[model samples]
Target: MSDVPPIWYEFRDAVYCGEFQVAEKMLRETPSLLHMANGIGETALHFLAVEDDQRGVDWLRTKGFNIDTKNEFGTPVLFEVAQLGYKELCAWFIENGADLTAQDRDGRDIGEYLLYYDKSEMADWVRKLGA
Candidate 1:
């Protein structure tokens, strides 16, 4: 069996725990770790969505990470951020060309999910973007 790199696990854990500083250090030391996924197929962006860190999101976006990458569940980064009512992150995703119409594994569109979560304002904003 091939030995798994310890830094990869550390990077994934740091992202999950919102330790952007540590994650960044790990990325700088081992750029290949940036592509590593968690058990749920979640990348650093997915963890950022869970942590709701706008700064971290902005930093990752600046690093040219794929904004629309889907997790194992088929949920896009923007969808997760939107579901959490992260207006700024959602707006950033929109500005950066995230696929607003992308759906999750459950067939729920981002706008539909926003409406379901009682975030009609965000849903309306998404609708306006498409118009």
Candidate 2:
């Protein structure tokens, strides 16, 4: 009998299974689900990051979801996509108000984190956004 919220699991599954349509419908129907996090504070955005589904991410943005929220570990959603090297996603995050200067609990800033891992393409894109 897992006591985790069903919506959170459903939201995560929708992203994991690449069902953006379902996710979109649910979010539109229940906006607060956007703020629903599990025991670890991971929302549907985190699942999107894990899936690397650009469309799902874009849908979330179109719905006015804030991508800058920090996770349970104090890491912003930017950190989730940092290693993926999705140039478009990274750029979109910056354009949509994601904080490049956000530091995680480990004290690593997002731009630095991108460069430290040699994600030059993404690093270059972020650098153009200024310090």
Candidate 3:
């Protein structure tokens, strides 16, 4: 049996399926949902990252969701996007001031994670940002 709530699945599904309006309505109706984490401590932002939903991420940011919010493993949304090689979304996060030096629980930086995940292009892009 999963420790995650049923509504969490619904919410994650809504975001993953690109049903932004449904996600928005759900969030508005249950504001606490934003703070709710699933079994892995991943919030809706993690789902948005997985789907590469930059606009949805921006919307959530405006709703006061922390860009640096970490999951149980201490991986922030930016770090997740970086390793996934979502250049555009990662760039958007960078432009919007996502923490560049954020480390996971193991103290591995985003660049290292990117490189380890074979996202050298993303690693280069991130390096250029700091240059």
lDDT (tens digit, per residue) of candidate 2 on 1-131: 65558987887678667687898787778788877877778777766765677677777667766788777888787776766866677667777778767888889887677777887677676677753
Choose 1 or 3, whichever is better by TM-score.
3
Model 1, stretches more than 4 Å misplaced?
Answer: 1-9, 12-25
- TM-score-based ranking: 3, 2, 1
lDDT of 3 by residue, 12-113 (tens): 777667687898898888888788888889787776776798877777778777777888878888878877778888888888888887888888788887
Overall local distance difference test of candidate 1: 0.74
Report the Cα lDDT for residue 98, model 1: 84
C-alpha root-mean-square deviation, each candidate:
3.8, 2.9, 2.2
lDDT of 1 at 5: 61
Collision pairs in model 3: none
| Pairs that collide, model 2 | none
Please identify model 2 stretches exceeding 4 Å from their true place: 1-3, 15-25, 115-125, 129-131
Q: What is the TM-score (0 to 1) of candidate 2?
A: 0.74
Error of 2 at 82 (Å): 1.7
lDDT of 2 at 56: 73
Candidate 1, residues 4-119, lDDT tens digits: the string is 56666676567666687887887888887656666677777677766777666667767656778888878887877877777777777788788867888888898887887898
Clashes of each: 0, 0, 0
